[model samples]
Target: MSAPDARPVRGKRPKSGDPVVDRALALLAAFTEEHRALGLVELSRRAGIPRSTASRLAARLQAWGALERDEHGRYVIGLRLFEVASLAPRSHGLREAALPYLEDLHEITRQHVLLAVLDQGAALLVERLSTLGAVQVAYRVGGRLPLHDTGVGLVLLAFADAAVRAQALSELDSPAAATLRRRLADVRRTGVAVFARRRPAAVSSVAVAVRDGAGRVVAAVSVVVPVDAARPQAYEQVVRATALAVSRALGARPARAE
Candidate 1:
């Protein structure tokens, strides 16, 4: 028989002391591209804790400057969190290596270009160059997209160790999701990612895996071109070449391109 005031629980149990801290983080996890802001009830429901508990946790987060209250009284991540998140080594390190080349590709193609890294099983855009006429991609710098949908996502998934790859696939529900295993296999075999326009062939993206010093894919470099002018083979060639140059900048020497 549970008491009426018993503590609410969700996710796995806290592995350490500071249950409040874990609950606070769980609340933070509820904010995603799909829902950047959440009311108290929604937050509590998503966090899987009691509303009273979530209220206390939210106050702590707000005080710590990790979250802010919106005009409508919903809570959203604050600039302080972005500042803290930026210090993550994977984001800053990969951006440092890819920024220059991303700029070059953007200038040469006069289109949208991006560099992304795999983080926590999602493709996190680290750098982007959006031209005046580039198609509207559903991603932005620091944004996370499914590893089973986007071009960089596939390449990142391809290079990931087996367990991570399996986990990502298991989360997708669309029929196309099943196709990713084969797509990733092809990417692993060819070291490049080629895709048609993300929106009704509005624009197509060509991507190549950028390797790290250990010959492992660390990031992806890509160019987005208008569908009308898309030449998949030509784009593939240039992107692969640029990716190799960037890889060299990072001291990765793949046998095929070295």
Candidate 2:
């Protein structure tokens, strides 16, 4: 599989001036979705590290199982990282509890189903299930998405703590912030959020929150469909029902019908 967010490593220079740490990170960041495997020269160029440094660090990373060379002597991300990432409580724990419902939803709709939660200031996708003919989306398990632009994100932002909301707003331009505020209000009022985008692909999404026993919104679940095939409104009730079932399984009380 391709690397996740394998963009050029960017930041102010590491304050500690630790060559080992800096070069190690640079090597890891060199892999992206489009450039999954690379030879020494390309890896060094992409990582902005000296060839010698990249070679040294790559050797260490390989020794540690963080990276492995392919048949052509190009490096690829190793399975060890995935093994470690599976221990993350926010994703793994919630995914374990929500998998049955997610499977049911996928079976019923044969579309993309996502489970996500707020991480830092973004929506962190914990799990996703997509069928062969499902609408294409630029999301994957363990990927981070913008808080205001995704269905799961809208639900998460709608129920996020004030501090997280504030942080997200502070980062947006005033116009965008205002639009997000309005959208969040709507999500809160309606108990669900629907989102769509046209640039990348014409797709629509419907999402709802999953609450814990204390009524705290712990996660969001969503479905994505091609715009031409979309019946977002029709999917709303099903998504909400699935979320409620998962929430109840996680110990949340059933809401009295209004």
Best by lDDT: 2
* Estimated TM-score for each candidate: 0.80, 0.82
What would you estimate as the lDDT of candidate 2? 0.87
**All models: lDDT?**
0.80, 0.87
lDDT by residue for model 1 (17-95), tens: 5887778899999888888999988888888877877888899899988999999999999989878877876777677
Q: Which residue runs does candidate 2 get wrong by more than 4 Å? A: 1-19, 171-173, 254-258
lDDT of 2 by residue, 86-172 (tens): 887678978988999999999998889999999888899999999877777889786788988899999999999999888888888
Judge candidate 2 at residue 67 and give its lDDT. Answer: 93
Q: Cα deviation of 48 in candidate 2 (Å)?
A: 3.6
Clashes of each: 0, 1
